[model samples]
Target: MTPGRPDPARRRWRRIAVVTAVVLALAGANGPWLYRFGSEKYHAYRIDRPEYKARNGRWEIVEFPEGYRQNTIHAALLRTGKVLLVAGSGNDQENFDARRFDTRVWDPVKGTVKKVPTPSDLFCTGHTQLADGNLLIAGGTQRYEKLKGDVTKAGGLMVVHNENPDKPMTIEAGTRFTGRKNGKTFVAQDAVLVPRARKRFDPETGRFLGNDAGLSRVYVEAERRGARHETGAEDNYRVQGLRGADARNTYGIAQKLALDKKDFQGIRDAYEFDPVAERYVKVDPMKEARWYPTLTTLSDGKVLSVSGLDEVGQLVPGKNEVYDPATRSWEYTGKERQFPTYPALFLTQSGKVFYSGSNAGYGPADKGRDPGVWDVRTNEFTKVPGMSDPDRLETSGTVLLPPAQDEKYLVIGGGGVGESRASTRRTRLVDLRAKNPRFTDGPSLGRGTRYPQSSILPDDTVLVSGGSEDYRGRSGSDILEARLYDPDRNSFRRVADPLVGRNYHAGSLLLPDGRVMFFGSDPLFADPANSRPGVFEQRIEVYTPPYLYRGGRPVVEGGPGTLRRGGTAVFRSPDAARLETARLIRPSASTHVTDVDQRSIALGLERTAGGVEVTVPKNRNLVQPGWYMLFLTDRDGVPSTARWVRVP
Candidate 1:
């Protein structure tokens, strides 16, 4: 004891204290790193807790093997319970040039991914689930956009006129048009078919009035890559390789073809991706080429395609068309209705289309920007009122709230038109069943958001998650928060935050297993300073809602493969007595924060001795003809794995 200065034990204790103090000092110097590591460990422990997950839900990241990863731009939940991930060129100009289009069929249950052959660059394409259970994908990127400084050639749209009443004319790709006034030659980038001119007659006199020239537009560029080759005024151009009356009948006119920025062009290509066959079948092309179009399934099961940049990179001027799955053909709607690119148009139970005014860039801001009910049959529109932050509808997410029979829609956060810094967290709710349906302010998000991904859960709650505080998630503004929106209470409950940030080109779709799968995020910059170009997020994330963590879930087994709209179908389930509600949720076809195909329809549930019987709605428009995921939820809102059912 008296040996404190000499004892070996005292000396060793002194050395231990010194080492502990040194370690503490070093840890203090690197506190942030140490704290972060501890916090992450705590988070991992907290989320793994059964009680925590039962309340707040859980998120898991699904990183595909390096060879299978892709910049998925669009996703669709097929009837076969597999997800179709499409990333044609994936916003990469190099891939587009290399003809490296990609599509993947991912089985979430089996955890397998298989690549499918992509025929065209389906980037920015419009897609919807068809009545035949095939996915109707139409229109896509024909050319990438070129910025002003990047454009080396003088180019603009050239309108070729056909004045001959006898026959149509074909202007092949690379066809030259020499200006008669300026003596400059320009080349067409693609083929154009100019129809025969229409000969008009007087209704009363029965006399020939005049021949109206038929016009077709094609994009043309100067032969030389110099400013001197640009045109400053409108000029008539003579069609090369044409002779006699044909030469005079077919001519070109272009206004001010200069070295300016060229917008992205679209193609008329369309296809039906058959989930059963796991292949794409070519269909009749669309009547008008489209980029960033919206395809809404009508009550009759025909998909209406509207609003996009055309072949010449100009707004398609309200010429909406429809695709008939039965005939595998598209036809003009015979009605003109203008909308911005990717406008949110939902078909209502009244057999009319409702435009939510939510759009994804392109077109003049002032025109076709009002939320309204559009009668496609009569070309009539009745504007709905009271949309908050109306100017910031761009990139907003619209969800037809659960039990779609109520016709209530929730429009989530959005930003201002095209690259504007403005954003809004305000959510707007509208009930079409009201005498005068108008949007009213609902619960707000925690922060300003854009490109929010909202998916309808089978339990009647909408999961609204992920967005950016800025345009295209510029300056590293991607928002990572998520919430469950309860339409029943008209409130939002904070959920577990997502592991990844998602913004432009991102989407979420509910899986058959009651989980939500999120894919794609294309940020504009990699850092807050916007110094480095951003990389696309290809890692898919699956969110398991809180309900999934509950002890046991009900089950839907052995249901009829087909159910009539007004008929009842019995499903075998041991937990039928515990089942509270049944929902027929339409599979999702999601892209660019737009998913009109995902709707949850409430079914009348009746518990039997050993199973449950569900009756479908009598209204065909209310329950659109399609393949749906039938889920039964118990008292705790825990849903069963979906049973595939077809509404015939």
Candidate 2:
């Protein structure tokens, strides 16, 4: 134009240019919205539904031919195609002490259950498959006690007097009352006052002592330190006579004494069950007694036993032991390698152990709860970041998805600590192959769950079933709907729901015939309320995936029952031309949402005249010495029944 003004012809051109500029700006601002609309419309017909294929698997309730003797607390798929079920009193302390038959052999093919005598109570024990196809079970509960009685009556309380004395201090039982003595903090354990003897009896130790003695003695030291005031005889008389009306004076009294030895004792017995001989042979016990421990098979074939309560029912966070199958004995690995009780530890391809952050019951809430890469050799733990809802993963299921070469780890549903009314539906995945491994959000389940079962299917998919939506299946939190997780798509599809609601103590395993069996569910921990009086879950159900219904399953005519490392396996299958994938899945020994020694490795497949030849990798880390289920899938992803193959 002319500096600030334009001529008539030039003004028209200027106006047109400004209008075009404005239009372009507006279009740029709305570009993403327009593009999204157009892209969605274009792909509307192509958007595929979440695959449930194999023809949509179905679940059927199957009754145990001669129902289980006890609730199924532990289950393992034997190399012989039968299942080994162990209950060990099934959380029934009375029955357990009475020597009830707690072990059984479940023959799925014959629909029969055979009882096996167990030497000790295997309740709350940990187990993993050894290289010889035998199960090494270790660390079980000597005894357990449910919380009972009034909060104040069992454990004495402590009251703090401050400027606001009228507020009335509310001291709860189990709350640690600490005092300062010699510049050190002293903690007072629970105690009950014996007014007649002018002393307190340590019920936990079954010993009567002075009111200010033993654990509670710290309170006396604290009184000298002026940390708090301990009311004397006059106050006790007024409080005890008023029927606890003046709780303030009694607030300093210790109610519940120490726990009894029988309540927290950990068993030292360790045994290896020979599935073929159907007998349990006692092995060298652990260096430290453990209850509720986790037995993990290391990449080098040695079993790592970590976490658990010690001889006295106390969480042993830093005391870990390694079991050498060669020596058939356990060696203490020191406290540095200690982890949370029942941590779901996965064997990485690099020979490192990955803690999946899924713990069963007991441990330090802060230390061993984080997911990390643990070097057993160096005792180094590298925490993996980016896990969602890590705090509430108690009893959650975790697994290294199929094609172990991918190096991906996944953790599914779990609940909060103790009796907290919280559960989670969150799932996370981490790629161990990454330079700095971190978790990423994965698929969520249909509902929040605790103690869910995740089983690796023959078709490289994971079937997740059972678990409660709340803590201990309260308020009808028992979930029955099952789901299938497809790693290829990173999505979850709803599968058929089972008839019984499995929660707390439930287990599942992949059957050799491409089916999945789900059993055991003790929601109340053997203390079923009057509303649901019967406690134990004695029923078993088998899930038949859609692949089974698909007509003409590729027949695995024959294959070597045993294989060698770095060996080639020639499988006789008439549908070799149609075969698309070959996979080897380790037999699962699953319990308490912990599936020990379960892994899937994809075998390199090559078509032959009438069968397929598969090359097994030589890496022992990828294919540890153990029994595996070899399966063949057709081009349609329909898998054939697995054939048991041992790599020894």
Candidate 3:
């Protein structure tokens, strides 16, 4: 061939290049096949990625129990490496009622959940785990007029244990009051245990009988020290309590993983708790209260506080703060994209923070692309791979799952892509570790709502829990469904029908043992007179996976018992009866599982025979309410039969 003549192979290669480029361009511009949703794939995930999503999501729903309570989920989940822990305020309370505290632990391998015990009310959004294995519970007052008829309750924090993972927990509130058992203790309110001090006021000799402000002698004091006062399994390292604030900024967070722990160690920056002195020393102050702000502790040992309302609900204008544990001073970062308010600040193992979702600025009205990430290395708010879902509003949750066996940072359900208030049932899988890492829309929440949180298990399963089935004033506000997201399968399956319908909830992962623990919510809280349809669920349940079921395949719809300290909970299967019932168990090891039939059981920190624990579920939703055995009938008539349910 002549030197200038194009070789047949060369000509072929050139044609291939043009065709490949054209195909990709079209795919980017239109939907998958240019049919169904002519909208481009980029339009769907909000990020540019055609390669990763083509695979399957490992997350999938395997098990769903019935007769479970439907309630609101509003607490945060704590992970210790193996187990998953979740807690929240029940729907019974109104407007941040800290009085009703409930917690549960999930064992992923065994697929079982246990309820720990708490003494007084363990408020919602006031629970955290310390490095020493103790839990730091926030203390405060609970103002629920329905539960007690206008008599507002007081609040306090209790330190509980978690090492045993199955034992009951002992708790210590600031003052010595008659516990529910003793009969003279004040209920605690929303509590947060930060490295700080707690103070109270006491009149010279003020007693309840006189008009002494109805308060006793109180003064300034430290909540926790090197560990805690009167150490033990519960609160041994957990102090009395830190002040818990109202959940603002659309997405509520207190910056759980901050690198300042070491700084709070020997250094004792200007405004931190002095480990040696066991007191609150004057350290530098943050630029703001960081109300509901998400935080990250960079590997370099600095704290980044971003996006929350400052006392008022206005997105802190261009608000982003950074704290130096060494200096104990807060500095102003730059303006973040308007993403946080109701967003989740997720940090990967690599020390990067992913700020996703928030309706902070626009409650259920504004139509805008919420902000995404605040990169520390670049010290700027960068765009996330696929965050902007115009349809999903109030994307308040962003959890970082462990690296899949193949290695990926799996980012799941955030807000909705529909109207601002709706939980668009949209979830995405992200692999930030990849060179061209992007997000892929995994599965729709299917009847999903808003304010839900997700947790990852050892096998790499993501469990999604609680959110309002409807918006604030809209119908179906309380959602009663929970699902598992299998990243490998690239899909979602409803695991259990909630005994209780809940919204604005949180989830945590416990270590050593893995289980998905879900807390319930009640809608009668704020306004008892007006019953918002599908408003509350007052029970809790644990979805035991077959892997965790030592008894082998459980008979579908077989009777089971509620496990707690103080008593042994047992049940007689109603499989033969008309229906099954959910046994609401509390933290007491006494096994006082009263044969009660309802949606869910609101919970708080309670004492177990061995260590600390929360209230848990017996059977799950989809069953009926009554004192009977739990056995699967597989009757075509059972509600939501399409949902996954196991039979013995």
Query: Which stretch of 10 consecutive residues in model 2 shows the poorest summed lDDT?
Result: 214-223
For each candidate in turn, the TM-score is 0.98, 0.75, 0.43
Mind giving the per-residue lDDT tens digits that candidate 1 earns over 1-648? 565457888789999999999999999999999999999999899989999999999999999989999999999999999999999999999999999999999999999999899999999999999887999999999999999999999999999999999999999999999999999999999999999999999999999998999999999999999999999999999999999999999999999999898999999999999999999999999999999999999989898999999998888999999998889999999999899999999999999999998989898989999999999999999999999999999999999999999999999988889889999989999999999998999998988999999999988999999999999889888888999999989999998999999999999999999999999999999989999999999999999999999889886678789989889989999998899999999999999989999999999999998999999999988898889999999998999999888887
Q: Each candidate: what lDDT?
A: 0.94, 0.74, 0.36
Q: lDDT tens string, model 2, 45-137?
A: 332222443445666677765545568889988888899999887887688657774898988888888889888888888999888889999
CA RMSD per model (angstroms): 1.7, 17.7, 24.9
Of the pair 2 and 3, which is ahead by TM-score?
2
Deviating ranges (above 4 Å) for candidate 1: 1-10
Error of 2 at 164 (Å): 55
Q: Candidate 1: lDDT of 523?
A: 92
Residue 371 accuracy (lDDT) in model 1: 97
lDDT (10s digit) by residue, model 3, range 1-648 = 888899999999999999999988988887456765545454445322323222221122323244222232433222222222323244344423444444444344565644543333322212222222222222212232222232123222232212221222222224232222222223222222222122234556543332111111111112322222211111212112322221110111111111111100001112332222222244464554333344444444455554443322233454566665556567876544444333444443355555544432222345224444455556665565565354564534554443221334434333443334455566665666567666667667665455564554433455666666444324545555666666657767665344444444333222222234444443423442334444443344444332232222212222233333222323232232322222221110000000011111222223333322333333222111212111221122121011111111
Best-matching candidate per lDDT? 1
